[model samples]
Target: MRYISTRGDAPALGFEDVLLTGLATDGGLYVPESLPHFSIEEIRSWRGLSYSELAFNVMHPFVDDAIPADDFRAMLEETYKEFAHQAVAPLVQLDTNEWVMELFRGPTLAFKDFALQLLGRLLDYVLEKRKQHVVIMGATSGDTGSAAIEGCRRCEHVDIFILHPHERVSEVQRRQMTTVLGDNIHNIAVRGNFDDCQRMVKESFGDQSFLGGKTQLAAVNSINWARIMAQIVYYFHASLALGGPDRSLAFSVPTGNFGDIFAGYLAKKMGLPISQLVIATNRNDILHRFMSGNRYEQHQLEHTLSPSMDIMVSSNFERLLFDLHGRDGALVKDLLERAQQGPVSIEDYRWRHARKLFDSDAVDDKLTCDTIREVFERNEYLLDPHTAIGVRAARNCRRDPAVPMVTLGTAHPAKFPDAIAESGLSIKPELPVHMADLFEREERCSVLENDLSAVQSFIADHWKHA
Candidate 1:
């Protein structure tokens, strides 16, 4: 399988190149030229496979000929072995037809670990083969920073730098990135919002001449195809666990960057029996507004209890628009260019096509807190602010009651104690055993202004790999 950029200008690339190339030269995200499909018999044959086994089956087609099957299998096995749960992404029933897929069982206690853990390994394998070193730059709202650090800290050929909005992320979220001590890991607290940090990362990817024209730049963000490829596995795992293929399943994803739910879109493309995909957002509801009401407009970014979903710009939405526009890159390019100036609307048919499969709702901080308290009261289940939005959306926008609704538990409740406490519950969630001493750990990070040149200089100055 080969990957093509959404803009349709970049040359078609194999999986290895797509893994290393974060953003296309034309400022587009990479998607497979064609998705692999599984027949009903093939889907049914995967009933009892373990998560790793199922992941290998789901993703192997994309990784075609990039690595030997045995080596790739071993890499996947070693990657997921670090997760805290045996069912790597397990399901917890909240109601008879409602369930939560617990995705924080990995090293960083967030859904990002599901993809970044494997991405780090994949990068190491490919870089080792090519005898090359690259700088991995990413912007995180909360979870991706720590998860990327944890995943790539062990990689010798990678110098990983993650920037997060200063004073914007939760304490646990901040500590998770700053606490990890590694020679190759660098964290920067930028004086801006998540969108600012994300814009800087994207700008840097567009122009890497700051690396002295030798060192290559990579990405661990959802922009990278590898991250999206790794994420698609869990959708299959979750759907099959709920008796998919025989019966359609519905997924409610706590979306921020749009990567997680886009994986669900790809799963539906690859023949998963998905009835609908729900887009759950906090106050930064650009995606929700677009999907729900066909108003693709950006508003002022809000600092919410769910810091991860506090994004005004949804990056991966372009990939869906690419397909919705029938793969017309020029149209997507025009639409995005128009969007930058102000709110832009797609053609009537395009809007209607997207609405068929996607339903969305925007949950503010008050509603988020209320949902958390309600879920705790009803099921005695604790939910993080992000997952609480997903649960609320799942209930409010579900298309059918008979179909099993799986809301992605994006992060552990302990990660957002302030939000949980604000729900009027006195209970304080504790860190898991592995992160028991998270508060006690010393942090190392640089406080930088949200300027592109300054951040680029820091990467150029401190790049040990270079």
Candidate 2:
């Protein structure tokens, strides 16, 4: 499949080229030139396949010719073989019509592993063929760092560097990234918010000389189309379980960077029987406000109980705007520039159109903790702080009872032990076998300011011999 940049300035690229280059040269995210569709019969025929088999069938069209069919199939199988659950992503009934899709059964115990595991395999396949090494630099608020590190740490041809705002992430989240001791993995503790770290990563990507002289740099964040493509599979998996288009499904995604919800949008575009995509956000709710037609504004980031969603600027929202504006780069540029300047006005008609497919709600710390306590007491389901926000948002957006609602359980509750404790839920989720002694491990990381020059210098110093 050919991919095009949202900004429409970059040259069109095939899937492999887009995979290797995370962001387009024109400063836009890559999206498929055309979305592939599956007939209803094809969807029904996938009922009895394994998760890996189903993923291969769903994703092959997007990766057309990027990897040989046999190689890609093997990669999918190997990537998911280590999942703790046989079913990979399983659906459990929460109420009569409400269901929870548990997505934290992988080694890293977060939804990101579903994609990052496959990403690592894909990188290995491509790098081995080309005989090249890559340095993957990413910034995460919580889960992505550990998931990326776990995926790329021991790979022979890749070096991964992950940065997070020091002291802003949860204790378990921090440990998950720091505990992994690998020669190829480097962690950075930035003395700022996630946006600061993210900006530094982007700035490094834009530096021509630094990017050329250093080892090849790629990204594992949701900005990479491959990560978003991997996430689209679970949406189809959930839909098929609900009996396909014969019945509709609704998804409640606990979102921060907007990549997760953008996958839902792709699923809808690909003819999934989904009704509403409910975007669950914390107090840092730029997306929520934009959808509500109030204003699209970025304020100072807030450190909340659900620290993962503590983002004021949702990066993947640019991809949504690209589609919303009918793939017109000029219009997308204008909207983004206006948004960056101040709160821009969105017409009521446009807002209503968006509301048809997307419903949004923001949960504060108090409500998030309350929802955690209530769900545990009522249904005996312990939720992490992020998933608690999703449950609350899903409950509020229950406009249709006939359609089954699926709330994405993003991370294992154990990742936020203190938050779970504060919510009065007496549950201690066991750590994954690989991370059982995370707290005892010595961490190795660099401390950096948010300056672009400082980040560039660090890359140049370490990557000179790479």
Candidate 3:
């Protein structure tokens, strides 16, 4: 399977190449040249397969000739074996038709683990075979930093540098990335918001001559095609569990970067009977505004209870816009360039077509807390602020009652205890047994200015030379 840039200027690449070459040279995200479609019978036959088996079935087409079948299966088994739950990604029923898909059971306790774990291993395999070394640069609002570090820490051929907004993340979120001390894993606390950190990463990718051009820079963020490819599997897993293919499923994803819900969009294109895809967001809701009001503009990034979704620029939205504009790369380039200064409206027909399958809502902190409290009182289930937003959106924006509405549980509640405390509940959420001493661990981190040159110099100093 070949991958093509959303902007259509970069050369077409195979799956392995796409995995490492993230954020195309022309400032676009890579998407599959042709999505492999599964027939109803083919999807139905995967009902009772194990998680790894299901993953192999759903993802092997994208793997193509990159890795042999047996080797890829072995790597997949190893990747998911670290998950705390046997089901890898499990579903818990809340109401008659509403449910929560638990995706924080992995090592880092966030939905990102589902993909990052696999991505780390895939990168190691590809880099080892080619005798190459890479530097992974990523920006995180909260969860992606810890998850990416944990995923790639053991890799010998790669060094990972994650930047998060200083003092913006919760204590737990900050420590999760900082406490994992290693020469290979470096954490930077930037004196800015999430969007600032993200912008730095994008700019660095745009011009990697800072690395002296000796080593390639890789991405652990969702801009990497591998991350999105791995995310597509869980949608299939959850839909099949709730009786899919025959019965349509609806997903409400608490998305900031737009990668997770875009995976759902891909699942539907691959013949999963998906009825609705809800774009759930916190106060920093560019995606919500676009879906609900046709305004794809950037505003001041807000710091809410859900820090992970505190983003002004939705990087992956361009991938969807590429499709929404009928895959015209020149048009995408024109629109995105125009959007830099302010908001740009798409054609009416395109917006209307998107609304047919996509609906969105933005929840403020009060509503997030209320939803958490209400769900706990009704179902005796506690939700993190991000998941609370997802549940709220699923409840409010649901179009059909009969269809199963599953909210993607993006993070464990323990990661954001401040939100739990703010919810008026006295219950204290505890970390899993493995992370019981998270607060006790000594953290090592460098506080840096939000300047790209300083960040690049830091990476150059600490990065192991190839």
Candidate 4:
């Protein structure tokens, strides 16, 4: 399938190009020119397939012979083979009608690995065919860094660099990225918040003069359409597990970047029988405000116990805005550009239409902890802070009691022990067997200033080609 930029200025591109090109030349994100929709029979036929098989069926349309079919299947098989769980992404029931889809069973113990593990393999296949090498510049609030590093570190043609907020992410989050040592992998701790690191990555992508024209740049962020593509698989997986296609289901996603929930939206568009979509956020709740009240305005970023959702700007929201404005790229560009400076307004009809598509809630730190404690006491299920927010948001915003509500369990609780402790739980969440010695591992990471030019200079200086 071919992809077009949201801004409508960049040339339409095939899948391979979109996979490698992070941001469009016109400073917009790539989306499918036309999405594939399946009939009820088509979706039902996929019931008994393996996760890899199901993912191939759901995602193959997007790839569209960009990679040979057998090769693509092999890549997908290898992608999920290393996951800690046999089912890959599994479902755990909390209430009779409420469930949590555990998504942290992958190598990095986060939802990101659902996409990144396959991303690394995809890069290897394409870059090897083209005989090319590229640099990966990604910004993470917490989980994306380690998942990206784990995914790309093994690709010889990739030099991956991830930047995260200094001392803002939990100790486990930091160690997950810093402990993975390789010549091709570098981690930077920015002396600012998650938004600062994200802005620097965007600005660098806009102007790559710092690379001195030696190597091209790529993205591992949700801005890349491939990342969004990989995430869409689990939504379908969860629905099928809950007897979908015949019965409609609901999803509550804990998202800061908007990529995860945006995938759920796309799933609905692709003919999944979804009754409702919930936008679950923490105190940094631009998306929650927009969905609940039609106020698409930014507020000062807050540092929260759920550090991953501590973001002010939701990047993937622009993709939804593209549709809300009826794919008028010029209109989207105008609205988002104005949004960068101040609050921007959407048309009355568009705002009302969006309300039909979503329900939302913004949970604070206290409620997050209470929800964690409550769920543990009620069902003996220990939730990470992020997932706690999802569960809370799901229950608060649910419209129907009969429909199955699936909360996207975004991370392993072990990764956020501090947040668990704050919930007044007496038991400590232990790391998975693979990461048992995570604390004892020696970490290698550079602490960098948040200045854009300084960060760009470091990438140029240390790039393998340099």
Cα lDDT listed for each candidate: 0.92, 0.87, 0.93, 0.92
Those runs of model 3 whose alpha carbons end farther than 4 Å from true positions after fitting are none
Measured against the true structure, the TM-scores of the candidates, in listed sequence, are 0.99, 0.97, 0.99, 0.99
Q: Write the per-residue lDDT of candidate 1 for residues 1-466, one digit (tens) a residue.
A: 9888899889989989999999999999999999999987898899999899999999999999989999989989998989999999999999989999999999999999989999889999999999999999999999999999989999989999999999999999999999998889999999999999999999999999999987899999999988888888888898788888889999999998899999999998999988899999988899988887788898999999999998888899999999999998888999999999999888888899888899999899999999999999998899999999999999999999999999999999999999999999889999999899999999999999989999999999998955
- C-alpha lDDT of candidate 4 relative to the true structure: 0.92
lDDT by residue (91-123, candidate 3, tens digit) is 999999999999999999999998999989999
Can you give the lDDT of residue 231 in candidate 1? Answer: 89
lDDT of 2 by residue, 366-452 (tens): 999999899888888888899999999999987798889999999998899888878866677778787788888998878888677
CA RMSD per model (angstroms)? 0.8, 1.4, 0.8, 0.7
- Candidate 4 residue spans exceeding 4 A from truth: none
| Model 3 poorest 10 in a row by lDDT | 457-466
Q: Give the TM-score of candidate 3.
A: 0.99
- Candidate 1 residue runs with Cα over 4 Å from true position: none
